[model samples]
Every structure is written in C-alpha cells, then in structure tokens.
Target: MTIIGWMIVFCEIAFWVVIVLGLMTRYIFKKKQLGIILLALTPLVDLTLLIAAGIDIYRGEVATTAHAIAAVYIGISIAYGKSMIEWADQRFQYYVTKQGEKPRKRYGIEYSKHYFKGWIRHFIAYIIGGGILVGLIFWIDDISRTQALSGVAKIWSIVLGIDLIISITYFIWPPKEKGISSGT
Candidate 1:
C-alpha cells in the first residue's frame, strides 16, 4: 500500500482511539469530529485508491476498503457528536445556572414586550448558528474541487436551518412556564 493508504488507515485508527477515550473518559469527541476527521483524511484514502486500485473516490469511481472505513467513521462520528452535544447542553444549563446569574424567568407574552423576544427571536438565533456552520463548510472545503459538496450543500440548507433553530430555541428561551404570572 502507498503512504496515502497508510495515512487513511492511521486516521481511521486515530478516530477509534479518540472515541474510545471519550467514552471511557471525557466523551466530547464524537460525530462531527468523526466526520471531520474522516473528511479531513478522505484525501489520503482517496489518493490511495487512486494510486493502488486505480480508482478515484472523489470522482465517485470506486469504493475500496478505505471507503468502507470512511463511511463507518462518518456514521460513528455523527452519533458521537450528537451524543456529546446533548451531554454538553445538559451540563451547560447546570453550569450557567450554578456559576452565573440566571436570566429572568420566562413568564409570559405580556412580560416579554419586544417583538420576537419571546418566541421568534429564539428561532432566529438558532438558524443563525446553523447558518454559520453551513458557511463554514463552504469556506473550508474545495467546493468545486470535490463532487461531495453538492450533498453537503443540499443537506445543510434544510437541516442546518431548521434543526439549529429548534435546538437553540429549546435551550435558550426554554419551555413556557406553566403556572407563573407575568405580573400585571
């Protein structure tokens, strides 16, 4: 095998090691990191196939052993990132409340006078974060250099906008208070 193939294998191995370490210890490095690492090392793996198997993964010509390994890395990474994000979010809520002053409790629409402050602002803020991530993908990758970006673009446009909005709104604005008064 060429150095590129070896590099792919090395990266794959590193991904697993990080995941195991996270699970056993901190558990922060998962899904996105996994995907990022896989994508980061994809060139190496693709190059190996180009050199050894005479196929180009970037051009979508062939699926080699490295391709399978890359797929696994993405799948596992997505799972890991999601798990980590959720874990971190829960802990973050606690940490913020514990260490910092709590924002005034969300009472009702009456108390929240600003337009969008209660509901819409929460959604917009979320989409903003997602939009930022999508923008990152566009800036970091060779969009024209690789065919894979089309898929990335398609997925991000939809999920990034909606999921980000939902996730952020849930965390930031919080659920409606059931029994509290806005104080008339």
Candidate 2:
C-alpha cells in the first residue's frame, strides 16, 4: 500500500478505537464531556485521511488496498454516522441519566418519521459519497493512472443495495404502538 493508503488504514482504525473508548469513558468512567469530545473528533481523523488520499490521487498515485478500505469506511460512516451517534447517545442517556431505565421508542408516526429521515439521510449520503469516489476514479484515470475504481464502485453498489433493503424493511415493518415524547 502507498503511504496515503497506509495513512487511511491507520486513520480508520483510530476512528473506531476513539469512538469506542470515548463512549466507554463517557458512560462507564463518568467523564461525559471528555468522552464526547473524543468521539466528536473521530470525523476529523476521517477528514485528514481523505485529504491525504485526495492528495495522493491528485499526484497520480494508483489506488491501493488502503484506498479501497478507506472508501468503504467513508461510505459506511456517511451512511450511518447520525444513526450510530444517536444509538450511542441513547445508551449513554439511559446509563448516565435514566438510572438503568430502558430506552424505548413507541411505534407511531414520529417513530416512522425519525427512521424515514434517517433513510433519506443515508440515501443522500450514498449518492454524494459515491459520486466523490467515482469522481476520484475518473480523475485518476484522466491523469493516466490506473486505480481500482471499478472494484470500489462494485463495493459501493453493494452498500447501496444493502441500505435500500434496510430502508425498505424498516418502512414495511412500522411499529404498531404510540411512541413516547421524551425530550431528545
């Protein structure tokens, strides 16, 4: 892997590690702001990695394994960032403030609405992020460099397909009860 690719790999690993550890510290260690700060900074790592990758491609380096992994990491993050953060936040709230109370969302329009919003966000992210990847592919090609754009595209298509399936399933299986109005 190129230096850029290795950087991406390192960044991706660091991103998840930070988030997980941050959550543990925030909830388990009772350090809320510090943990949240660490979790929130994970995206900056992604941004730096992306800048490095972009610079590499701009300088005519062919994409490598690291690039491919980074592409998937970016795609997944774009699609799931909000939902994942919300999930973590809910868990944190339950443990930290709710005092062991189980978090619940009543099945209602609001329930469906929140998920539908998430679906739209994920779909839009796939489009924008996928376009960026494709643009990078073309850019690399235009400069006479051979990158694994096709392979990356294939992987993206699978991600899109999976997201679509998930959204559809969520829509079809709406909850039947009324959701509670907890100040989120």
Candidate 3:
C-alpha cells in the first residue's frame, strides 16, 4: 500500500472517532466548544488524505483501487459535509439544549419549510461538489474523467431520489405537533 492508501485508512478512522468523541464531549461532558472544534476538524482529516493522494498521483502513481475509493470518500465528504454538520448540530441542540424527548419533527408546515430549504441547500451543494470533483478529475492524472464524472452524476442522482422520497413521506405522514418554533 502507498502512503496515500495508509493515510486514507487513518483518516477514515480519525473522522468517525472525532465525531464520536466530539458528541461524547459535548453531550456527556458538556464541553460544547471543545467538542465543536473537534467536530469541525473532521474535514481536515479528509483534506489531508486527499492531498496525500494527489501528491502520490502527481509522483506518477497510477490510480489504484485505493485511490478510487479515496476519491469516492472525498467526494461524499465534500458534497454532504454541510448537510451532515447541520444535522448533527440540530440533533445536539434538540437533545441537549431543548431537552426534547426525540429529534423527530413536531409540526408539518414548519417541517416542510425546513425540509424544502434543506433540499435546496443540498441541491446547490451537489452542483458545487460536482464542479469541484470535475476540477479534481483534471488534477489527478491517472483517473478517467468520463468514468469519474459519470460516477459523480450517479451519486447526485441517487441522493436526489432519496431526498424526494423523504419529502413525499414527510408530506404524507407528518410528525405530531409541538409548536411552530420547535420543528428543527
């Protein structure tokens, strides 16, 4: 395995560990700032691994299975990082600050509005993420542009389909009511 390959392994481990520890620190230990800092640093792990992979490819290494997997990882992280972080933040607030019994939706209207906004946000993210991946496809020498771009397109389409299903389900079976302000 290449150094980049090892870095990907380390990064994947560190990413999840950071999330777990961050949640533990914030929720269990009540160290919000420290936990948030750690959580915010999760992308840096991905970034480091990506840079290492780029360097490896630049040094004339062919794109291996490891590199392709790393590209997929990086692509997802880039595309969904904002939405994932938002979700975690809301979950933290709902459980800890609000002391809510659960994180499920309370009202239909407000929840619909929030869900629509999230869909829009994620749509924009997909576009930006796709563009970035296209750029990176150019940067990495051994990867096939057509294949990678096609893969990215498929990912975006899949995500879109899932989001649509969730939206329809939300319309059909809305959550029980709390207050308008508490839907987050």
Q: Pick the candidate with the highest TM-score.
A: 2
Q: Per-residue alpha-carbon lDDT of model 2 for 46-113, expressed as tens digits? A: 78877887877777677765665666567667677767776766776686556555777657466667
RMSD of each: 12.1, 6.2, 6.1
Pitting candidate 2 against candidate 3, the one with the higher TM-score is 2
The parts of candidate 2 lying over 4 Å away from their true place are 1-9, 92-100, 103-118, 143-147, 158-162, 169-184
Colliding residue pairs in candidate 1 = 30-81, 31-77, 31-78, 31-80, 31-81
Candidate 1 minimal-lDDT segment of 10 residues: 45-54
Ranking by lDDT: 2, 3, 1
RMSD of 1: 12.1
Q: For residues 24-116, could you state the per-residue lDDT of candidate 3 as single tens digits?
A: 788778998999898889889888977886777677666555665576677667667766766776676677667535566547767876776
Q: What lDDT does candidate 3 reach at residue 4?
A: 65
Q: Tell me the TM-score of each prediction against the true structure.
A: 0.28, 0.65, 0.60
What TM-score would you give candidate 2 relative to the actual structure?
0.65
User: Which scores greater on lDDT, model 1 or model 3?
Assistant: 3
Candidate achieving higher TM-score, 1 or 2: 2
lDDT by residue (49-152, candidate 1, tens digit) is 33432234434333334433333333334334444434444454456424324434544443434323323433443344334334433544554433333454
After superposition of all CA atoms, the RMSD between model 3 and the true structure is 6.1
